[model samples]
Target: MRAVRSIKGRLGTAAALAVPLAAFATEASAHVKWFCAYDVAGQPRGLAEVLCADFEWLTGLALACLMLGCLAEGTPLGIALLNALDRVTTRIRTDTHLLVRVTLGFFFVSLWSLGGIILTPELTTDAAWIPWLQLGLAGLLISPRTTPLVGFGIVFLFAYATAQYGAFHLADYPVFLGVAAYLILTGLGISVLGLRPIDVVRWTAAITLMWASVEKWAYPHWTDPLIAAKPAMTMGASPELFMKAAGVIEFTLAFALIWTPLVRRTSAIILAGIFVSAVFEFGKVDAIGHSGIIVVLLAIAADDVRAAASRRQVVLAPAYYGAALAGFLALYYVGHALLFGGPAELTGMPVI
Candidate 1:
């Protein structure tokens, strides 16, 4: 009994450490992309379309299963499955390599530079030099000695560029804020702060998803064009129904991230899977946009945190977090509509 108790104590500590790291892995708004719409005559006009590709129905099904699993995580069957996952991830956490970290850093930098993800609007054909600058940053990330500084620089530059597009518009893509937070936290985690990088990543992921979910609730019409383009997205339901359901699912999963360890990891897995599956349909842009989220998810999956108590120590109760998020969304959209006339008015910029 004493030996068993010791083992349990050690496992608890391991799980506590894992909680912070696992927190980092999650999808930034489930890898959704927004683009300006155009008229038949090729004139850039209308609100941006919330688009998805590559078996959206299947993705939805998977997310549903994930949600169900999260709800059942306290059950015996769920406990068994989570234990199995924990065992597998335990081996992985012990094997994290520097090469892998550098590679991920390089990939993100490349994506940013190539205009495959964030900054896509700013790094247009006219601004050729921007890509070159991003590429230079990518090169800097390849070295451990320089990774921290380069990461900070990248985040700062991204924030500056994002601000140029209009602070109000920034609310539309809250995932970029998550990305920026990840870069800053990772850099600080590596060099200056004792903060766990994965923890920072996880919080940003949750915050981004929760924030972006509001867009779906406040402006479901933004997704109408994407559903129209790919009728299969509706799965026989009306576009409005699909959009509302998707918004709820995304928001719930984001909330789950702060709920418990099993649910958080499971949500990250499902969210990452949805993002990855979309790459097959949306092509390079989807892949580039989601790469950072995927890498963070991978890190979370590999984390060996198994402590149940650590999950309870989170900042807010699930209900409180959900309510807070809803309140913020209400204020944001209502204020924007009152000021600009409608949410669609904010999307009047030209396609990049």
Candidate 2:
């Protein structure tokens, strides 16, 4: 009984803590590149600088939330939450593939209409064939028989963009590959490895968001001008602190997407809300760019089958979150250093 009460109390606390995090989440999903000046080749801030005291405190708080959330997963409240999610998402759950297809079809058609875009808004091209290719891909989405081909076309576009830009710049959008994989696997009626089509999309979306969160940490200065332009977005916090907190919140929620079923489903709902809110604040470019992942998150929220039934798995979630956090941070810093020379030196405080 005490254990049950403990879990309930922790769940309530976690829910309360989540409010402040969500308040800042709009900026977390707003594509910084769309509103800010960025250089793909420019050096990011050093890891030492990013891992400062404030960052450590935010990380600690995030970990606490993760622990509480994981513990809450075993409680009756968690099961109730999942049931509520399932009830709310009945329509989306019934038409998962249709949702993805229609969204992607609209997205591709919009891209075709826009013209001169490579894959995302920030990545532009002078090639005349790309818009027509987008149009062709949109046409392919008209039938499930040809949807897999649309997937292949998306892969080609991603590859072409990588060739035009560098791999590092393209890394910002691996969710494209996730969308492609979803289209391919769903159309073919097959699972790759052990994961279903939507499973692949869930994992990839988590990776994409986590990578973006790391970028916020490494290049917080890149978004300084953006915060300057839209001071209201900061909600009274200094831009520097806001960026750090946003990175932590975004990374933590992204990691939650891959956790036990209830945790991940709730996270998907929250992330989807964040992205949707960003679309409102950042407008059409945000909507167009984020359309694919938003569909994936919706699918994840509606997923009822894939789950961690083992209590032990839920208990170890914090450990997994910590290790994954460390691993991704290492990879982001080391990979950038290898690809784009060393980190930049800052003469003074970098937070504007």
Candidate 3:
């Protein structure tokens, strides 16, 4: 009886650990391929179709849940969690050295050269000058004095690449580009408009995740092919259900970033782990695509923004922020559905 009880306890502990391990492992894994439509041959079929009718009701229910969760934030448990989070954030270290910046620059340049990082990697026009341009930018980023120029150049290149690919088709990756640009800008400079660059990187990174999360909710079917290919992603749950849960997890983490510095760092760490895991599945493109986000997460981890003891300012109260986020998501998803028919209608159809 004693041996049996010990075995049972061991099993229970394994089960508990497995749940979070699975969740973290799957974070952001079903990306790139999902946001846009694709054929069975793995060919791009253009923008993903948004099935409004299928998910509209679900979205509403999720919003209601969010509202309830937000209300709960005012309770003692929430306050305690927030206070604990503040303590963690206050202890983070934000000071970065020149070597880190130079290393990051070298890494990005190498990725660009390898054709890992770019908008619509498979679809870009074959141009000889692009590599040279990337190398030039990388060189510029090595110096503190030239970092801002390289930053602006990167912003332009990313924008140009997106425009070349047709902006509407690529969808949310541009948000990642914006984060990269900001990181470059701030890493080279002390501050932007009196705000620490790391702070801006934290906020922007959070926003990028939040924005990408909506696509999962709005177009779950976009990920159907991926789920079909990798059944393990479902982890025994229905594909639809898993997609919805994934979106909620991503959005909740992103929302947590705004709540406290501790939460921000925690979210960044989790997100970085997810991105790292994705590289194993998606290869070089995943690494290239997520490099900027990973860098931002690292910066957030290094940031040491402490809360003022005298006056703690809540940037946006949880309740109001949650409500506003819900409203914005509804508008964006519904509007997208109206403009472009849902996945069922657009499957195999080219956006252009």
Candidate 4:
């Protein structure tokens, strides 16, 4: 009996650490409630499985492909970016700002070409709209010389198109509207704030970071397995509802950071720390394939932080696959599944 008690104690201790780690990994907003299908191992109310991808899913794919290509051409892009940074860092080394702008223009043309090829019709039912909308966002993010009117026209045109098509769905409405509103409001906010061009770009990136962080916070249950009865893992499990609580913390921090300029950099760093720790603790062996963008975004956030501090801004570049977004995101979700098992099982819901 004494031996049995000792073994039980050790088992309990290990499980405790495992649960929270698992919960947080899959807890990110971008991945949350994304593609949960009826095939989901128990009978948790899975989303209706559609035959083809929706606009959002297609947009995500385009964003992914765009990022992948950018990473592939990392050397030139990085050099051009570095030169742009040099221009920003000081007044006069050489009058090569126009060259950097020209380099970015070429990148944009290449982006359009890539979007044409990679955003294939097979992936999305709403194929007509997806590339166009994503391409618009890409434009705003890339050009260091973009004006608010140019951005406004691009975003508004897409918004008008979506409205014309009446393609909005209940599940996607909030996020779509929210992101749209963010772009418009921020445009106005930048005008009011008298923000520089680079500042607008950085703020756009920062807001996205903040929103992504807030997403997980809003749906903490997606990650928490201890919100399970069997409690497969410890870190993702909750002895005292820690996952839910942490959700509150992350959500609050993300929101606070988005609205407050001074806190934005700090918020980006905090969010990055949270994501990196979550990845290390709970990400699975195959995480690299899926969650790569999130990781790269964090690294990009680091650049934003430094830029904000040094130059009071960051010149936004077009979206690119970045170093390892898929890998990182993939690891995170895999960890969530490995650690948590299934939502219905955790919650004691009868399996379908």
Candidate 5:
């Protein structure tokens, strides 16, 4: 009775602690979600180059193609494509997972639509679900199986369309092959690696940190625009340090999540904040803001994203991964010293 009572009290205490933290995470993750669209020129892209670079434009072009396909294919063809997609997705038989995924994707897109129109500077008032309604129209083409092909075909067409753009470089055609290659590899990686939630959290955190770190490291001026754009960034005590420290913190936390269980719990809590910031920071722009919303939706569904492990696993895994992390960092320290001159995990080990 004493031990049981002790356990209950501890549980109650832990729950109490978690409440404020959870609220902080949610509020931090929350962006000024727009409920309508604006017609402002040049306001489409955010301050981040990721919001303006190939990734952003390509996504926009792809979505535009999805729009075109819906227009070209019409309602019947869309339904037929969906039915065909259902058949294809069933082959792998991850329908339950895929259903959850697509629904989240839909929900996030809708949220983005709401945010896009509400925050945008140009559109009158009716464009609330603009991109999302387009997404909905295209959603008809979104059967698990067919959605892949549809998404692929649309992206491909966009790339092809863009070959005629920008200096009219006939040479640019080969460049697209690399992009195509990346998409193929990405699709495969997601299916193969994302089978486990632990893998998802670890890799996503690592990737996010790496990407964030590289932008600042490569260009000293990189964060100036970011700080300028996010009013909240200014509020952070030492925004510059906050930016740099956030990168290192994420990198370390990602390592902890993968290798240390106790740290995983702590790191997961922090990462929840990191991801929300990433989403809000990204989502404020034209293209990626919506993408951020989509990712957030995915995060919500993948219960194991920051999920708790079994008690037994928790007891054993943290120490194992922690020890592993020490060795890995040591190895990194040496390799960086010998070859790269010094450890740039802080600034030099740039994002791939």
Candidate 6:
């Protein structure tokens, strides 16, 4: 009975998390939106509320990890790791276009098959046209000449979903826009601002992860049911502490995605592993929903672009991470407060 309900829970109407317990292992593990009603415009937990002692310690540890990763970037082991990664991903790097198209082709086709889904499992729609649009997008991926059309199609879908669901709710998946940009830029064979298509994708993926991590912090209670249902996920830690550590780990690793080559590639690989690991626990919903980003991460992992890393850059990474972390935290909390009202006292775990 427990297993049956768990399976049904994954397929239930997507909302948002609402508990004070252990949460999803990674941002991609369980979209809080999938299982419970979420008041996106509701008052979020204030920054003051979330800065508990545990949060402070976990953050400090995360900063240490970032500083160490930066130092390692200039070491012999880092160079060797990069070389080994390069050798393994040679074909993937060379055929990034094919990989993205093939992955997206299947992704859209799956959406078409599922029907009613906007972009993921939780965000559903009644419009009959949506599945057809997804099907059309899948068809568009078959030809390089038509790939630009596919990009435009994705933009339309994102815009339409934003209109239907509101921008804040839709904001959870900027990765779609990143995928669109990659398709459009690669298809058109033009470089805007001298940035490679893959680099654009990498940046957007980083942004998406960081933003979701903030959601984990602001709405830790939203995932309490998930934690309660899957207590083993907490690894014997209290649910609240587990959620805090998860958020810090997620945020720190996400920020690393934009660091030096060694750091970013390693971050990509670790993130990919985390997402994949989630599939075993959450099953097909996670696997299908996360497939596109997984492919993107693999491409990033294989990318051979060696940006010249100097001592100055390595020395400044922790500073950048701190700034980015502070900036995102402010954005999420203040944005919610301004859009909603003042922070309200959180109640008990919400009944889904």
Which candidate leads in lDDT? 2
**What is the C-alpha lDDT profile of model 3 across 139-190, one tens digit per residue?**
7766667766766776776777666754544455545455555656665665
What lDDT does candidate 4 reach at residue 302?
34
> Each model's TM-score, in the order given?
0.68, 0.91, 0.68, 0.36, 0.39, 0.88
Candidate 4 lDDT tens digits, 80-116: 4344433343432242223323332343344354453
RMSD of 5: 16.9
Best by TM-score: 2
Reference-based lDDT, each prediction: 0.55, 0.84, 0.57, 0.36, 0.37, 0.80
Tens-digit lDDT track of model 2 for 215-331? 998889998877878788889988888999999989988998888888788788878888888887888999998898898899999998745556687568768888988998888
Tell me how far the alpha carbon of residue 319 in candidate 6 is from the true structure, in angstroms, after superposition.
1.7
lDDT of 5 at 270: 50
Per-residue accuracy of model 5 over 88-174 as CA lDDT, tens digit each: 434333433354345435544554455443212222234344455435534634444444443354344334344423212111122
Instruction: Write one digit per residue (lDDT tens) for candidate 6, span 1-352.
Output: 6654543463231112212211345533567777656778776676787888888888888888677767766566567667767887999999889999999999999999998998888889999999998999999999988999998898999999888878887778898998999999999999779999899999999999899888888888888878778777787888778777888878887888888898888778778877877777777777779999999999999988987667887668767877998898877766665555554432222323
- CA deviation > 4 Å runs, candidate 4: 1-30, 37-125, 132-150, 157-190, 193-236, 239-243, 256-263, 273-352
Residue 336 lDDT (model 3): 52
List runs of model 5 lying over 4 Å from the truth: 1-104, 107-142, 145-147, 150-205, 225-236, 260-269, 277-352
- Give candidate 3 misplaced runs (Cα > 4 Å): 1-30, 34-103, 116-123, 167-171, 174-193, 308-318, 334-352
Instruction: Show where candidate 6 strays beyond 4 Å.
Output: 1-28, 343-352
lDDT of 6 at 31: 72
| lDDT against true structure, model 3 | 0.57
